[model samples]
Target: MLQAIRDTHRYSPGELRTALRFLAPLGLLIGIFVLLPVLGTLAGSLYLDTTFLERRFAWFDNYCGLLTDHTFLQSAWFTLTFAAVSVPLELALGLALALLMNSQVRPLGLLRACVLIPWAIPGAISARTWELIYNYNYGLANALLGGLGIVGEPVNWLGTGAGAFAALVLTDVWRTTPFVAIILLTGLQAIPVELYQQAQVDQAGALGRLRRITLPLLRPIIIVALLFRTIDAVRVFDIIYILTRGGPGGSTTSLSLYAYRNFLGGDFGYGSAASALLFVVALGLSLVYIKMARKLKIKMR
Candidate 1:
């Protein structure tokens, strides 16, 4: 038993030195930025204070208060609903775009570049652009609807709860679907053309080939793309900030926005608790994705 333990744990001095050298930079970064801040936030969340100047350890009081906080609850629900609605739409649109781009069309390179334009634009800029387009009067969206006689008057796209939510979702989908497409496009490109050739030789239809060959092989990439998009969607701030500012009756305030408001209001302890909750939610979703990927036997590189 002693020999086995020694064999398992032992490392030569040179190997130890090499390992430390490789790990040093990453360890330093994690310690300074990620580890210390998380520890501080967790510690801070347990206290009751205004700006940490007169803090008192409150144990789980802050968490308990959070559960009953209407604004926080609403923001949490909004964040979840936003992610739920937008991520799937983005994925579907992205997959469609990837399929279109993956086709053997003329000027495919140019088409791919054009498709990246929306994703290349900064989030704030895109949000502002969408805001203009969704404006009540003289906006392109309203003008188009009027031109097509779809509505008798301009619809207030961001003036009501449902409209604001829909507008936010639309803006997010427009800005993010391209990113999903680019990731999935790389995945689609990685698929061996020979598989399709074999399927064709077996007299498989296009839909059959896609269902049996393309999707199964692309499962890992799809999972990865969804994971990335879901994380981004959950923490979405800049776009919402620029477009709505959680306005039109606080209908679209997200968890991040709620935390920001609390922090700005000098409730550091509660703000930290909110931020910690956000971290936990993001971490939990990521773990779920990892488990699903593993269950699907998808090898990630």
Candidate 2:
């Protein structure tokens, strides 16, 4: 690969132009569907736009409001904590489940399909299902806790601030863990069997081989999964909206939900500012993760 770089003269400007031509349509689509909308929202954030009111440019006043908004701060904290907690849990559980599925466990073979069932159900439907599971009375969660003698009485899973937050986290983990598993499983399968065999011949144990070989080779894929999951987790809405409605003292409201409420309440400027901030946060995290991955790769060399 280093030699190939040194021989870069083999590549021509014609090839570069051909590649650009091929990519032009994709760039155009991104500009139309993504860039243009984002630019529009950023512009909208500068206004005092509201329903039945004269549209006026406020120029960062909306953003300034976010600094003093208690609910906004709480929602932002909830959003960050939710992603911080959920993504790692998903990744860990997913790695385990993926390893199990990829093992010689024939009983787990059916799980390849079963794992996707929760994810396949529409988000709205799944959220409703979880709502029932976390219901204050006669719900599966309460029933199980009662049956196991874990709690003396039914817990208000979705009616209390902390309980509601926990419920959201658990529901999200259950719903999205399968997706992480699938991504890891694909990466797991790509690893050469001979590497493991070689490790075994060297008298390496399962744990040793996994840490030394599997994880190191799978770093790039893991980063990809983390990137995708982190972005999705931050933008989470449908499930939270359906389950808790950002209720129980507004302890579980995510930034996306906050923005949505703003939009629904006809405060387009505030909503746009919230959304633009979310975009910045997500983009910043993505860049950080990518840079960390690159740094790790370099360190490995």
Candidate 3:
């Protein structure tokens, strides 16, 4: 029996060689594609001015400088505030849309297609379109507001700090809410219709049904939607960049925007450190979301 087991455990040289040959390419590809870039970013963050190669090892100076910088701190605060406001709004709007679409409605297909249109457009293009819409001279927003006697002046939406921040949030919410709605719609569709019918038979009203049935079933999807929105909002750059360039007074300058500015200013070490910090923030958020997901799983079971 021992001899038979030993024979089974032993691999022939030819088989071992074939297995190594197959795995070697995969390992090499991973090293080149994945491992190298992460290592390079870390190395760059640690590097300082070097006459020999334009940069040299500077240890934690970049990170320390970033932590002490007022602009970086303000940018971080702005990013958190943006994400905090936008994420909940997206989830709420998305959930409402999903619920509305789930009901028997007129022209449902057409409505869904229209709802997804904003999400289909390129973010940059949408930002530019919104910029025009918010223009001080001929923008539709000021025209509508003026028509309603909401304001005497054609408000310069992109020409002020608060206006620019509001514009960024509105544009981002419009562009990304469809994504959350789609995710929630999938969750809603998976829910058994019988559950709703049962609730009706129990004489549960809309609020009760939503609280007792819909929300419980939709927890996972809600968590996932929040995760996606939070990460995206924290890293927001393109829309704000295109719309206001984090402008008017740096009101909308986020962490990612700061990183880009640093990189453009040729502060590679600082930029890399900011990027690494952003990565850490994103990773921490993902872990928290995953933990919440696990808790939901336990509750469900």
Candidate 4:
């Protein structure tokens, strides 16, 4: 690889230089916005004080403290549970929607565009909208339930512990399911038409085709979408903050919200530690998914 790269560069030095020139700006931007912040966070996590006025190195103390911190543990647990539940739901609904969109239907272009509306809307806006919908008095949720005679009184959707968690999950699902659907739809479109035709000639029904061909082929794309959604769910903050503010006894507080609270409270070191831990958790999850995807790909091959 090294000799090949050297030969290519020797034969086309100008092309190599031009490519480097074009990439320089992107590399600089990533360094400034991504790499530097990550390094700074890692460094800050090792110290007891982030401010230059009172710098004190306390290696791993903040991480150790997190193990015993009830708020941190609770937030971590809730965040994990949230991702675990919401990711699968999003994948299932998204796949179903993708199947629907992939079908031969009237107004296909308009339907595809309409499906993306929820995903195109900002999460903060969606959260606010859902908050209003879930409001106890004069809220759509309560009104609809009452009219259907499901509940005699207005249920405080965001006030109670279970209600707040469910509300957040529902909000997240509505906002992100479209994104998952779009990804799966792309994957679905990439599937070869010839394969389906052959399956039809072989007397394979829809379920058999899906089981043997479609799913196996779509596995990689599904894993990619799942990884994206899982990471997003783990780092979720804006929607939860907007809707519940981790209210009702901190039942819905996510790791990101917990980190933000610590940061705002001037515990920079602790906040950075929490942020670093969140990064690690997200990275760990991504790595696991990548490993599983690679193994699956190998088996498929």
Candidate 5:
């Protein structure tokens, strides 16, 4: 009882007031910027607010249509598939890059900054650049492939379902891998060097040290990176819009894009429904990711 009392922290009334004051601005901002918009969208989803038509209450009809809409289903599947594939690849590549950065590489500052360039580039600009690279005639990708004898002809990257999928995956991985690497690198730097030194003294080889020391320590950060990347992938929109515009029979249409299309077509009620559903999915996945991470952390500890 004595130890528990010492371990507990109790805030005084002054501290409670100060803390509340400090948090008030953040609470207000969230209310205005996040909660209000979300609530508005949810309320709007229940009504038919189309142009040149009387506003009518929808009452979940839009959601029922989404359940049976072939386009919506296809887009949802594609979005899930994109996230499933891209998130894992990003994790793997990010892990490799983080390991490299963690090593004693020269010019570390410059190299770290260079690694961030891809991520810093605007999505629309990068997408446009990639569009050119995927061009059928004289594009850089095909030129290299042909020069290296990898293929006889230029591949139509955004012209087919499979090709477009692969293109988007590669683009997303390239663009976002650096973000994961940076996060993982922070975790790597936090690990005590003494741990590695001790492992080495115990006759642990490089692989043994990495497996026993590095990976276990880095697991939490990896899961966090996974959560972020998966969420970004699930809501991927601007890149798809700029790169392929959900081309090749809408094979790459993400749920976001699907909803955007409805909004563009003036189906406000339906679009709001789609947006609400996507928000729910992202929220659910984030909760699951956090819970799983917590469970793993507890198990490991």
Candidate 6:
């Protein structure tokens, strides 16, 4: 009994130490970064006014007002439209780029590296660069159009609602497509060469092989890539904010930017409500993605 007791005591401390070592850093991260901020935000959102220099509870008034706010509605719609348009286009373009890169093209390694450069750059920096290019008077975009005789005057690219929206889409696409390409490239590279070899032996054309073999095997990866891009696009703020500030008459405002402005503009509770709503949307997308992933897994099996 003493020997068994000693053995138990020996293992108990070791196990406890091991568990503590694993959990300590995680606990610190959660407490300091995640938990604290979330609690602060929630607490702030419940207050009557953050700017009051005094504390008072507001209950659900902020949330109730947010539901009726026209600006929030417009921002939500604009953000949704941006995601709906951009995510599908990015997926298609990225997959196409991945396939092209995967082909027996010359200097494929260099090509892949070149393609990733845009995605590797900081998004705000990319936005700023595009903003310069988009400048009406002295921009390269106008110069190119002029060179091509496409227009008689320098297009005020960011001066109109449609123009600003288009610019945001273009900049985002340019910056993020490379990431999509990289993700799809991983999927493409995972495809067995033997499958293609056998398909060729069976006299399958490129399109037939891709349709029958490549896509079936790539569905999961494609879904994953789409999910990642869609999530990012849904919460997109920096590019649009920097380029348009939801301007040209709030034409390009997104939910994230809207929430940020509310919070910064001293409507903390309302902003928090908007943020919570956005969280719901993001969470819904995540659930859908997970369901799709599971369905793909079942189909694969």
Task: Evaluate all candidate structures by whole-model CA lDDT and list the values in order.
Answer: 0.90, 0.89, 0.87, 0.90, 0.89, 0.84
Model 2 agreement with the true structure over 1-301: per-residue lDDT tens digits: 1122133265589999998999999999999999999999999999999996899999999999997999999999999999999999999998998898889987675878888787788878888899888787868888998999999988887878877887888888888889999999988998889889999999999999889998887787799889999999999999898988898778889999999999999999999999999999999999988997777666655
Pairwise lDDT winner, candidates 3 and 6: 3
Stretch of 10 with least lDDT, candidate 3: 1-10
How well is each residue in 167-216 modelled by candidate 4, as lDDT tens digits? 88888999899999999998899888999999999999999999998888
Q: How much is 207 displaced in model 5, in angstroms?
A: 1.9
The runs of at least 3 residues in candidate 2 whose Cα sits more than 4 Å from the true structure, single-residue gaps closed, are 1-10
Runs of candidate 6 with Cα error greater than 4 angstroms are 1-32
lDDT for each residue of candidate 1 in 1-301, tens digit (9 for 90 to 100)? 1121133367899999999999999999999999999999999999896765778999988899999999889999999999999999999999999999999887999988888999999999999899889988878899999999999978988899898999999999998899999999988998888889999999999999989988887888898999999999899899889888998899899999998988999999999999899989998999999898777762322
Candidate 1's TM-score reads 0.90
Candidate 5 lDDT tens digits, 139-219? 889988989999997787678899999999999998999999999999899888999889878999999998998898888
lDDT tens string, model 6, 191-261? 88998999999999989998999888888888888789888988999998788888988878899999998
At residue 293, candidate 5 shows an lDDT of 80
C-alpha TM-score for every candidate: 0.90, 0.93, 0.87, 0.91, 0.93, 0.87
Taking all chains together, the TM-score of candidate 4 against the true structure is 0.91
Clashing pairs in 5: none
Weakest 10 consecutive residues of candidate 2 by summed lDDT:
1-10
How far residue 60's Cα lies from its native spot in candidate 3, in Å, is: 0.7
Cα lDDT tens digits, model 3, 72-152, are 988898898889888898899999999989998879999899999999999999998998899889898999999999999
* Pairs in clash, predicted candidate 6: none
Clashing residue pairs in candidate 1, if any? none
- State how far residue 175 of model 4 sits from its true place (Å): 0.6
